[model samples]
Target: MPRTLRASDTVISGNPSPACTEPVDGEQAEQPVLGGAPSSASLDTLIQHLVPTADYYPENAYIFTFLLSSRLFIEPRELLARVCQLCIEQQQLDEPGLDKVRVRKFGPKLLQLLAEWTETFPRDLQEESTIWLLKDVVGSLARCEEAYCLRLHQVLQALHQKLAALGPGPESLLGADRPISYRTQPQASIHRELLCICSDPYRLAQQLTHMELVWLRHIGPEEFVQAFVNKDPLASTKPCFDEKTKNLEAYMRWFNRLCFLVATEVCMLSKKKRRAQVIEFFIEVARECFNIGNFNSLMAIVSSMNMRPVSRLKKTWAKVKTAKLFILEHQMDPTGNFCNYRTALRGAAHRSLTAHSTEKIVIPFFSLLIKDIYFLHEGCANRLPNGHVNFEKFLELVKQVGEFITWKQVECPFEQDPSITHYLCTAPVFSEDGLYLASYESESPENHTEKQRWKSLRSSILGKT
Candidate 1:
């Protein structure tokens, strides 16, 4: 750890000039130690660059630690111990229960290097601080008899002994409790916010579209498929599953769930008039989504209404006008792999080229974009049999991805509307997806006869009374 003067280029904390000595021979023998190895200062600088700074979110800290672990040349113990300790300590400051998930995000690679590759750890590996790092990994990996379990078991025992020697075990804290004041009490008054916002479908659509954009902004385009694909396509093009890819999948599920829930609420309403009103409201919402180029929510709204639970509500349908609804449905028809949607999206994109302040493409329907990405994934090989890259195929995918990226660049026209935000965020309790689909499947004669039998029985009883 101490800096010694081997050559002139000894890097210190502050700027220091290299020592200059007069040459003895005809030519200087001290020809600047020609590239033998990087100095300690250079290695430290590399680590500094690779490691995440203090401002990094706790969730990403493990990844920084993961990269640090891959450096086999370094003194892996002291540095790695500090990283683990800081991650656990920082995560505990916010949500203590989330520490396990946070640490596990670094993956099994962290443990593999520490247990198998670390030849000579620092003398302080027996220290309680260092042992706790091993224990955290043990808890995260749930390793009972894996390759690293023997070493980890000994480390855990040492840590426990050190803790016992210090004092009694600390008292456990009580679990978090939800308070009564959090719930809103019911009242017989008009919801002025909803009444005002419901009439302006454009405003409502913009708000919903904005929410989608907010979620989308968190995901980088590269990060979406980066984790799903290989580092070098020519080496091996097998799909690799990872944490970020899981996040992308979950994001799609949320969109689908949100769509279905809204329609379920509309269908499950008790009053036919209010229910009819909500249907018309959602219909206008669909139209607004189409107009604003937010086809994601547009598709969501149309599909939600088409869900049989909403569709079989014949009474509600009878009162509703289906002109706009029919138009939207025809556009989303899946017969040609939803090519109709592809054309509509292209047209909407063309209209958006003018870049007016009044209109913005808040959220482009990335469903088609994702579909294109899937085709790109499966349609062509990344490399040809001759070992050259399939550049044509690769470029085609890149072009599609480029268009997808460019589509999101349209200037947003509207500011946040709190009235619409409140409406979209809050929703009534709804049954599961399976329950709704089951309701739809039971609409045949056997179920209809059962329903009619119960109705006639009720009628007979009322007549007798």
Candidate 2:
């Protein structure tokens, strides 16, 4: 890639200094477009236009993560996209093998902020927003000191309680002219419809490919704390922290989306009989994924089933056939440190070795491996007591990261049909409010008080019902 972002000069003065980007004056720069994250040229312009004397290691990006998490922005999603893109660009420029993380320094600071947020229970932000910010902080701090593990667990427990109170959110489900009754539909018809809407494995692989490139990336030396910071001219190949944080954010979002779709689809059935059909539909979805050798979606689908909202539906689960569900869950078993998933992944890798180039398979497990590497990162130091590179520990982590990259080279030969993409993406997404409503309605259909019943009946007539 052509050089675009300027390198920040490191003086090793042991004092904070200002950082700036050298302007890239090029003919390719053009007016910003109407949509999407900031244009590349616009990003360049914005960076250069900043005040000249700002502090180098400022907490702007870290602070932005909190604000972004709160979703108070006019366009929260777009804002996040813009910032992440900027960070990715800077990350690419920091290459040359420093192998250090730029933002890991913010982990402890972010944790402090989260602790305060939890304690004070900031009233200005909605509970849902605080919950999401807590998740973001937790994701970023996975590689924090081992001693903080208990603290982190406590934080999660508190967040979970807060979420139960918050419900899904204030927004209700959107109106559909004709709410399809999955219960009334025959299993075969439902299966046929699902077959039509099934995601193209190739397109799914492409998404994984995009994530793997950015997520599995290594960072540089300047990104690390002073203890691990080596100044040897040849000692500059450490990994950056941005890649891990971004990857974690992306991975969790992706998995949660799949989970959301699964839970929402089942909950939205509105009829008790069809709930079983939803479970069966997903079971087949997982089965077909296995047949196609797409481990990524299989993990996602299975994980979705295991979420509390879905698991709490004991009546629904009792109606589901356990054979396929058991096998699939066993396949992804996290026991003994995911021995089964690792074995399955390796077998899938070996099987795809000789498959026709046009029919090649891609297996990407987003959650497990990333979490494993995070454990590795936290378990050992990258440098020894004398500040020498602990290549042994480093190499082990590198081996795991390298597998995602290497396996990614496998070709996703099938061209994605745009129609298939649209069909699969058409599933209605639920917010916090929707999930809570669905869970309550499913769990307690007849438990409403007489007055509550009349109100619900009235609301139902208006579609809010």
Cα RMSD for candidates in order: 21.2, 22.1
Candidate 2 vs. true structure, TM-score: 0.47
Sequence-dependent TM-score of model 1: 0.51
| Candidate 1 lDDT tens digits, 364-398 | 55555665565455555443343323333433444
Candidate 2 stretches with Cα past 4 Å from truth are 1-248, 358-362, 423-426, 443-465
Query: Which portions of model 1 miss their true places by more than 4 Å?
Result: 1-199, 230-241, 358-362, 426-429, 433-465
lDDT measured at residue 247 in model 1 versus the true structure, 0 to 100: 38
Instruction: Report the number of the highest-lDDT candidate.
Output: 1
C-alpha lDDT score of every prediction, in listed order: 0.49, 0.46
lDDT of model 1, residue 301: 81
